[model samples]
Target chain A: MSTKHTIAVLVNDQPGVLQRVSGLFGRRGFNIESITVGQSEEAGLSRMVIVTTGDETTLEQVEKQLYKLIDVIKVINLSSKPMVARELALIKVKAEPSARPEIMGVVETFRASVVDIGTANMMVQVVGDTVKIDAMIELLKPYGIQELSRTGVTAMIRGNA
Target chain B: MSAQTPEVRSTEQLREKWLKPEVITGSEILLRSLLLEGVECVFGYPGGAVLYIYDAMYGFEDFNHVLTRHEQGAIHAADGYARASGKVGVCIATSGPGATNLVTGIATAYMDSVPLVVITGNVATTLIGTDAFQEADITGITMPITKHSYLVRDVKDLPRVIHEAFHIASTGRKGPVLIDVPKDVSAATTLFQPDDRIQLRGYNPRTVPNKLQLDKLARAIEEAERPMILAGGGVIYSGAHEGLYEFVNKSGIPITTTLLGLGAFPSGHDLWTGMPGMHGTYTSNHGIQQSDLLINIGARFDDRVTGKLDGFAPHAKIVHIDIDPAEIGKNVPTDIPIVGDVKTVLEMLNPIVPYAAKADAWRDQISKWKAEYPFRYVDSETVLKPQWVIEMLNDTTKGEAIVTTDVGQHQMWAAQYYKFNQPRSWITSGGLGTMGFGFPSAIGAQMAHPDRLVISINGDGGMQMCSQELAICAINNIPVKIVVINNQVLGMVRQWQELIYDNRYSHIDLAGSPDFVKLAEAYGVKGLRATTKEEAQRAWAEALETPGPVLVEFVVEKGENVYPMVTQGSTIDQMLMGDA
Candidate 1:
């Protein structure tokens, strides 16, 4: 009965509001997979994309509990309807002069870019859905990834406008 | 004549009215805001950070304040006051240690859904986060427990925030709200404006029950042959006891209340089932399991009531009506959840739903169970029983006195023996089960209703938790009676150890407790003790006759345990009974 739910939340942009939202997850014993917060289209407001894994009842509880926060204005379950979800990841792989050419080929195939390159390692940046990011990470595993940083899933409803 | 615009005319009138401006300090602003809220009495202790507010409070002649020795006592007193009277109880404390002392009390109020406006002073705004003297991040610490909180950095936001704090604390699913004011904010001067209107976009509580859900519920009640009504503290909160009585009388359904819902329905009613859940009456426990349709009002099915979650009311279809959306299905899965206040929902429900006069068989079975398993305890000529004392107290008070109890075997005995027929007459730490709540809460209840008799029942161990409040009673002449059931041990814990842990009594002994008579007299209050039934009767008579505060200790037999106990992890019907 486990489900992956993507929720989009709008809240007033105020001090400690972020803590208020995230702390509720911990206090209520809800498991949150990833959360991304940033400014929204409206001034003095912020939007958040949270990816959590729970059952059907838990998904309902999550949305209801989020609405209880004083700063939270709206809560919508994006995954329940047509929605598009994406994540950004930066992977640093150990690449010498010989491995650079092969790394370039893989990055080009995934439509990624080599953001920074040192004599020993190269940092590749990829923006895609979660599956694409995971596939790219797997391809570069043999080359030895020095570091990996992923911005958890950020989502939006598909084209109402 | 030149045409004058309406905006221009209004600006000119404002300028004329403000020719002489009146400015007040932040402490004055706080006092004025509370006055606007119609707060008459506040329980608190003054400290260095709140000294300015205390100094400003001196001129408010009508504002009564009770200074307790500890912040925990102050907050619990306010909680007790709020529960007794339908007003928001206010309490104040200082920074760091003072604010920290109120944590347990805040949690207690939070669990029981009591309305309290907690105020705390902090170091100057500049000194925040620098580990300054007597500074604590009370807002951060209390965020999880409070419905909402504010740490005021500017004095101008005082009126608005305090107003919102009171509004939020008293409205829908009422709970405690804390307002942390910096010392400098309290000392600064500001123009105080009292505004009656407030706009909070994220905080509107739904009060109207959905029509479709209500119709479905009506149909369910009409069709259900074995329906039950389980009422909780929400019944008392919404003042729907009378409505409930009228509804159940017409419906002919058996009703049971939760631990906190004891006085929401008349206990002497013919169709009344006893309290439900752990430590619940035998009829109530069995009745819930067999019910086909359960109508829950204003009560969340807590774990103590549900026992094993999967097995609780397995055959019943639950229709839960509560104001808080989060509580609808928090503990047990709820079907047909109607989000609204109990009173409003009942008003709409009473007229539309047809009475279930068809549930005659179910009602008969409940009555048979009640008669067969009535609460009974044998009288002993040699030893004084705790149950006998409670029964005597009930007989003495005629079930008219407001009773508060601490957590232990004594509290359970009180719940089992005392028959309450009115709302808000039973006040105790139902959620957090705080031990030191009895004495301070009695002080609060007495102050709220000066004419009514308030008696606080405590166990020997729990009484010692907040015994220092005896000074508060004597100093203020609050005229509240304190009764301690002295079993000379942690009776509840000892019972658990004896039944489940092979009687390996660990640290349960409290044999060295001080003499109760001397302890009360030391605080300038009359104290009396009774070791036998005859002496207990005489002492009770004398204690009630005495004018001011009195403490009576009933030294009862040790090794007594509360029964009809559904131990943890067991289903509600699987209870360990006593040979009463």
Candidate 2:
């Protein structure tokens, strides 16, 4: 049985460190769904969140192999824990005068913001879970989506430690 | 004291004079760092990219550089030296093909956990991404295989990089580490401050076993009716031979070793049951199959040892002790997993294990199996059996020579017949099964222990793969004896073709191979040949007594096969016992 796992890794924020991590994933044939990396609270360390699909055995092997890399400091599988995950998306949609009211209605329903407005098109910014973002994209497809960019899911444990 | 002059001078002036940094080239820093690491010998080949480093190496009396014919030979020799001497082996090569040539050797060392520090010279930093001449991204190419790799873009990082390379290569689950230095960096000048300590935050390896797990394992051992100990290469890597000996003797348990674990335990001991898995002795395979508790130390359950995954050691509750956590439950499910160094774990377990000589029936059953299915071969008057050649060599050397072998039937034969009494005496490419590893490794072993005899047991096909290394031995006057068992075929593959593929031999025969004796003579080394049993004994005696490097070609019976064979997809209990 295969399941989705969100794994967070702490690593040295050095050049080619991300390449080493992604290279290991590619070589090991782990199917990565989404990956996001950003600087952490520490000055010289970064946090990488990777969402991948694998069975129990495959996921275990992936974690072990990742730890073998010298740049990787620690890895934690956050799927089975209480954690919060979010993805941000910027979507541009063609907006004719007739479709403006419908687009605004859809945006209001999803509680998203219209960041940019032009005569022919408008850009909407959405920050939510992957499911919410996917639903917002589904509704805006009928309005002719001009362009879209997504920052992959970033996650953290939900607690005051 | 000199108050009149010191009155005018300040504290900062005195500190500046005392802490003046010594400036040196990166190449010199590399050499000095290696000297600090206690690397006495280095195997390498020079090329365009490494000219500066080689120039720096010219007058360094602290290092002895053995120039090999090819880059692969250099790496393999270093690997062999590391295995035999229990020290980190050092090798160097230039960029591009010279660096790529070391790929196989690097993977070989990586698989077997042999400690090696491999240095490669790269193109200038300005031309690194421009496809410059003699340029290749060796650090990138060897990422997955190496334990760690560093590309030195700054000369200031040279001393620290060299120190870290040696530290990583020789620590934890020891493996090869590569340092790729750009030519410009090697030529650049920097302040040389030798730092003996390494501060790697993420590279800490667990060495001590947890007391809770040790107590649990001790309880399991005491509760078991039939307990067996399986040792592997980790025992030798951790220097745990004495601890293992003490534990086994105190516990009164039967011991079976993996191929790489050959010399860790004395082969002639009363409790020794020989190697286990494919081509293992009958007693060992049967004992492992019947045991209720299987205690594995420093060995992963490799597929060759496991046979069919579900059927392997079916009844036993497995307790796997290894330093690497990744190895646990990777192949088979482990009941008690203790991640620690083998010696440390054994020392902790030695006192906790209660003395229970209560398995008399199990010992008797093992003895019965050993008697019923002993390793046997028929003698021939016209043709010499390959097994007989190994036996003769083993007898003549009295099991004292440091033995290394190439992959094939000859390797299995040596593993079966040779009785090793001490650690670091038997070296072979067990995990990767690399051909052409024998002769060069023997040369490395010889260089490590100049006073001791080193012998390489190689097959005709495997011998030809690295036969060019004969020149290294001849020129350096390395007194290593090479015995080529000429079966005229790739015996192991041919055996598979005979049994599994209905005898459709394809490119397995080496009938027109070169005359090995003549080849040895061409290299200005003594050559000997043996066609019969009496001739083999005499030839071996003569070769052993010879002054420098000697090659003895023994033309043995063709179609010889290693037996007590566990056919692929079959369990260890279902081995095919060869004709008695």
Q: All candidates' lDDT scores? A: 0.90, 0.90
lDDT for each residue of candidate 1 in B1-580, tens digit (9 for 90 to 100):
0123233335346434422234888888888788778787999998988988998987455468888989988998999999999789999999999999999999999999999999999999999999999999999999889988999999989889999999999998999999999999999997777656778998999989998999999888888888999999999998889889888887778999998999999989987887888888899888999999999999999898889998999999999999999888888888899999999998888888778866888888989999998776777889999999999999999988999999989999899899899998999999899999988998888889989999999999988988888888988898988999999999999999988899999999998999988999999999999989999999999989998999999999898888888988999999988777
Show model 2 residue runs off by greater than 4 Å. A116-122, A144-148, B1-21
Candidate 1 clashing pairs?
A: none
Q: Candidate 2, residues B390-474: lDDT per residue as tens digits? A: 8888888889989999998999999999989888999999999999998899999998999999999999999999999999888
Q: Report per-candidate DockQ.
A: 0.81, 0.67
Docking class of 1: high
Kindly report which residue pairs in candidate 2 clash with one another.
none
Model 1 clash tally? Answer: 0
